[model samples]
Target: MIDASLPEKLKEKISSFSDYKIFTHKNPDGDALGSVLALKRILEFENKSSEIFVFNSIGAHFYFLPGIEEIRIQKEFKDGANSPALFVLVDCASWGRTGFPFFDFAKKEVIAIDHHPKRTDKEPLALEIIDLSASSAAEIIFALARELNWKIDPEISFCLLAGILSDTGAFKHSNTTPKALKAVSALMKNGVNIKKIADNLFRKNEFPGQLKLLGEVLARASLEPRIRMAFSFAADKDMKRHGAEEEDLSGLANLLSGIPESRFSMLLIETGAGKIKASLRSETHKGVDVSKIARLFGGGGHKLAAGFEIEGKIEERFEMIKEKIAKESASWRI
Candidate 1:
């Protein structure tokens, strides 16, 4: 949970910053992108100049966002002696995710604004503002803007709304708090099209994407009959054969979680050459914590929605994981 006294620290930084650069996680999700843009808009309203860096074609989905034209890639320009003096990392915990090329140069002046649960102070971070209870990092930004009474333009609202909608899977996830709803209500009031955003995010899909989804559900899927849970996996080859993209698989993991009698659901996709990307959900199971499993495999997420990756031949190692998960399932109860 983020400390209530966090605002005082944010205020202190705002008072001192002349110029800053905003960064987000690699493959930046909607929440990550939205947080960066929302923060930039707020600072701009205060006449504080800033720049945003979106890495790995994160800006490719520009149509969904408001001011996509202004977002830049850090590698395209040089950071000189007088360039941005501060770096703001949004929706990212560790430094590796922050796409800023000059991270070592900007380490002392970086600020981390995220909403993931934490156990302790991650060493070497300058300013940390995290509140897992808030749902989206955008929600935290909303609270910060209100605390500072900063002007939130319609564009800012759009950014924040994008973050909120994306992270909560359009309010399907458990993290959607009352405060999140209230923040979204304000964004809607500020002219964000809730319908359009939801449609673009959830409904829009090309033929290839549709085929990818169909193939995944029809072929790759498996059901743990004992737990009433269904799962599936898509290897890089599967994606290539169906002309698939990562965006196409973004929420496909949730499909199996809807089983009528399910206690839990999961999915694993081979995203990397030697890595098996996983999605573990607690659906109706209360006795298991996927986070513990994820930690064992060098990944992390919430108890209800955790993920991990394993190294080796995707098919060969998957059986080992399934056996381990079955053992864990034996100890599980609704």
Candidate 2:
């Protein structure tokens, strides 16, 4: 159901604008792309003009999603060219996340739609539609569509289903709720091929190097028996040795979290000379809040899954993370 306070306001604002520029966070995942594309299609159906602006190229895995071809890179989107009436920020927690110089277009009204909790570091401009309980940003978009009485075609259904499937770990993650499944059911009613979508997302033809990287990561995994936490690292040299890109690091934490003795797991990858990216995951039943650890390092996400970026020597960063996790786990009864 739509929030009573915001839907009317959103309806009024959407009806008033005929042109819009949409943005999602840099290095977007399926939920971010799906939500943005679904909204763009909905706007176009209403005879309004809408365009997507993203900082990075969409991953090849997402090419199957409808409207993937329509996304524009940051270099191609000019602030004043279109004079867009509304800047719709979808699935992004903060304006800086768009990785575009949004300040240059500060005159345009903004609409922030996201499923993550608001960040304490930066305040977003314009009306906010944040629902942390929602499984994915696409779930919120689905509710918004119903409230607006917009028509849902097979393409849109496929897009929404992709978002839900990806963000919910194919409905196996903790965020999967009855409402989320109901949304999936509704989307499938449009004749979306659930199996096809699942296969395309989870059974993609992975590079042999990626498989080798995963094996190396597992082989090097370290465990803290007291905390029941497992961790691994992939330095730049490791990636080079394995012929793997940073994208290959995806799902590493989740794979480690499956260890029967592990209550939580972490994966740290050296992104650049002095930069590291950390991905954290915890068993939903373990009562571990990895997002708290993420926020400690200037990042945010849900309780079960979260990530952050930091700068330091790889060993130093790993030690620092271990200390923080140890401190956090010290208080847990488990």
Candidate 3:
């Protein structure tokens, strides 16, 4: 049965923590940003005060959403008079992953309304609306509205729709589950322009992004029978050369899998941001747990799809990760 106490719990949480602040993961993605902003907007309607903060910086592209002007960076929150006490970290599985490093926090209750798979760091969470089977945390937020009977406005629908498209690769990835589809379905019923959200996310790559993709594909393209791996080893110079943004890194791993016989593909992108952002794909099986591979580098996601940012060089971990995949490939086959 649907949890009867959920609505009361959320309402109580909102009412009791009327002056809470909302925090999200570093390098805020659409899902993380959208979840927090959407929740913040709804809470305000209930006379609850909340602010959305990012653990790091985001770009203008991400700021294209309706409530985009409201996001405050993590550092900005610290330097200013702190918002409210009750801190709510949205779309993140754990505190460590939240990117604020627990700065001067005194909130009695912590809430995690996310869809990311629960890792070890996710322990000690006060309230977790973590539906691992859901496509994105934004999807979970929509479900939260239905289950808790919160109003779903156009802005909320737009944010969640963007997140669904972003996290699900515009429904290209296999992580797009039945619940995901249904959540988007509900949003469409609420008057969200699914196509506009799609155009914003999938169809809006800039010139530099296109160049980066072509360069990455050219530089690190590797093949092992049916498998493919593309890599881009660049520092400041290369980024300047291509003007590639981190979001451009999102779908690179799938690029390798598109070729014939390559059932899986991986992208080992060396970022100017001092981390190797990984994206993975599987043309063969939707049950293969890529999260394990991502967990090695402190990342998490669902089976058949996952990604992470490596602290060290992609070149250093490249061989080890490749060998690891080779050893585990048989188990991954459908």
Candidate 4:
């Protein structure tokens, strides 16, 4: 059953303001960037002014998307006494996920559009369009455009298709659905280059630095025979030695997930001083909910893919995390 009220409400909320601020999670991925960029284009079509804010710099791979240059690398929220502006959180539910605090300087309405499962402790922003069944937030954005009777321009199609391709892994992931395929068909009709999108996303990371980083990750990775899991860690030194950027580590967990016998994979990277980031991945057929594991460590994402960050060295509590993963997977049939 489709709840038509949410998009209708989104339309209403969007119509209420002329200026808007769009946000996505930190270290924004393809789906994150794609969703926000597409929304920015949509707002422009409606004659609304908008700006995109990302906490970290995006990878060069996504620079091919339209309007990539205008993204502001925001450090802090500097809310002033400007005219009323709507804040739209795309691909995430809370402002905290944007790697920034929710500023209470003014009374403003926020709308969260996401495809992740609804969080029980989400922020007070209620104009949400969360669809867990959708393959990607891009899918939800396309649906909203259709519901609001907005034209799907070429730029919007490019951005949305980039997002869908990203989350679906070029229609290879388990989340690929008939709706996603239909969206692809429509976007193709709009003349989006699937080959270009795929090449940029998957093949563009074949440089020497990324290769060295991959070698380090693979060499350090360990396979837990008991749980059929693969795990590894990359520290600041490893990244520096390899000249690898954070974007280079993006698909390492998925690479580990390709191990034939492994049911789960995790990659830990030291993102900042005393701060470690963990990426977890499992196959949909394996029936492992990585998000549940992430939630245990104060982070969340989809079932097959999720992540969390902790304030400590990579080796500080790795054994403890392994114990938690073991306990979590104990009930699995695999």
Candidate 5:
């Protein structure tokens, strides 16, 4: 069962508010957007005024989601327009993750919902619903919907299903628990098109350039047999050479994690000069907590998958991470 007190408190807060603004992290994935959109639809169904505030463009793969067009970027959101009484943050672990203009907005009543491990560095908010055991923030949303006794229409089902599917790697990831599977079954009963959502999320229609980039990154992958870990890096130059964007690097870590001998995999991308984004993933049975490695660099996520950003030369950062990982893996009996 889920936490009763948190959902009940959120229900009371949601009931008291007529206008609300939803916020998610920058470069939002399906879990982030899906959770936000699903919540927005629910509030609107109750005759509450709600809008989602996100920065950056969503991935093209998510275009099939209902109400996808209504999402507004941070720049487009006008300040003080509706005087929203409540700010609902979904799939975001910390206030800083909300990005840009929304982050600048002074503290109002906040309801933060997420499945990621909490960062002790960040202070607690007015209402926080965090269940790291849940597969995704969408899973928590599904639970909340049940607690509120809201109707689960097809659109809502699709949104929540997408979130859960995406975050759990289509239910193949380690976080996919029995409860998550039960939730998916319920969503399917609500008329969610499972095959269509799965195809859209997992089967990407790759452009030639993206294919080239993927090949290049994979061609240079390094395997550390001692730790049963593999890693690869892509520089901005490499992206330009292949005519690929940062989004094209989406599944690189997952791809690498599938290596037969790899207990974990890491993918580092040069987002900008002297800035690197690192993604990490580990096999569920490896007994390695990649999230701990990520936390050492000020990032937080699930044990199997996590990521962090560093400001340094790609080579320098990679070496630093390698050393850190090596030290951490030294204690492993594998």
Candidate 6:
């Protein structure tokens, strides 16, 4: 069931601010893009003006989503210490997750809308409409709209559905819940094209470079027998050689997680600037909580899916991951 109080509190908080800025994690996925876009539309529906901001580039696979062009890209957020507008973080809560840990939130009011597990760090600045049981942040956004009696347009419907589809892996992941499916059914009733969403997300839009990169990464995949973990890495050189972007690595971790012998899977990509992006996935049925592993490195997400970034060479990070898994595996049920 949706929390009755959250929407009311959000409505109250939003009324206090005339302008808003929406943010999501860096290297955003479908859910991050979806939820942020949908919320922008929702705010408009409420007659509230808002803008979307994100760090780095978004994947081409998501170029088909509505309102894709409006999102302002930034290398980092400028100081907002004196800004009066409220900041709404979708899909992730912590500033570190947004890839800007030092962003000034000193006296700024903030709201966090996410489906991930609660963070152990400092709490949100204002309202937090978080549902750990939600399949995706898009699902939470849809419920939020329903709770507040806000009308969802066709564009907003597509955005929400795209997020739900992206995070649920087209309803294939274990996180696919009845409520999520019901939400999809309701969104489709608004005349959104599910085929277009599916084709772009999974099949039709894949470019030659992305395919080559996938094959190369798959060939290098290594499975640790003792821990039942499948791991792989894509060097920055390889990414450049194939012309593949960060978004192309989206589903690779989930693919590795499909190995029957593996309880969890991880994909590490060297994303230049001495930084490595680690995407982690676990078999929920196997009781492997990858988020715990992510938290140890200052990242967080759902138990079955989480990620973090590190500063170093890929080899060193790979060794660190292996060691963390070896030590952490003793606590998880195989």
Best by TM-score: 4
Query: Model 1: which residue pairs collide?
Result: none
Clashing pairs in 5: none
Model 1 regions lying over 4 Å from their true place: 59-62, 74-84, 99-107, 119-122, 224-229, 260-262, 284-287, 324-334
Q: Can you tell me which runs of candidate 5 are displaced by over 4 Å? A: 75-84, 101-106, 225-228, 327-334
Q: Assess candidate 4 and give its TM-score to the true structure.
A: 0.93
**Model 3 clashing residue pairs (backbone):** 226-261, 226-262
Cα RMSDs, all models: 3.3, 2.3, 3.5, 2.0, 2.5, 2.1
Model 3 per-residue lDDT tens digits across residues 1-334: 2255665676676666658778777778778777787888888777777677776688666767887788777554452344445677777766667666554333346677777766665256566666667778788778778877788888888888888888888897777788789888888888988877777666655585557656755576767643233333444345556666656555556665565655555666667766777776656443345666677567776566667777667657777777766666556552
TM-score of 1: 0.85
Determine the C-alpha RMSD for candidate 6 after optimal superposition of all C-alphas.
Answer: 2.1
Query: Model 4 Cα displacement at 277 (Å)?
Result: 0.9
Candidate 5 lDDT over 162-281, as tens digits, reads 999998888877778999999999999988988998898888778999999899899999898876778899998888888888888888898898888888898999975568888998
How do the residues 1-334 of candidate 1 rate in per-residue lDDT, one tens digit apiece?
5687888888888779878878777767788878888888888888899888766566345457877667885444345655546777788766555544443443357788988654334436668898878889999999998887999888899889988998999998888888899999988899887777777667765686657566655576677776556677777777777777666676666666665555556777776456677887766344456676666566777877877667776678877776776666565543
Better of 2 and 3 by TM-score: 2
The C-alpha stretches of model 3 lying farther than 4 A from their native spots are 1-4, 76-84, 103-107, 121-123, 208-213, 224-237, 284-287, 323-334
> Model 3 Cα displacement at 109 (Å)?
1.9
Q: Which portions of model 6 show Cα errors greater than 4 Å?
A: none
lDDT per residue for candidate 2 within 1-334, as digits (tens), equals 4477787788888899998889998888889888899999988888889989889677788888888898987544557654757888899767777867546544668888889887843454668898988999999999888877987888899999999999998998878999999999999999999898788778756688888888888899988886778888898888888788887778889989888888888888996557898898988777888888788788888888988888875777777777776786576643
How displaced is residue 112 in candidate 4, in Å? 0.8
Give all candidates' CA lDDT scores: 0.74, 0.83, 0.69, 0.84, 0.83, 0.85
lDDT of 1: 0.74
Worst 10 residues of 2 by lDDT: 73-82
Model 4 error, position 40 (Å): 1.3
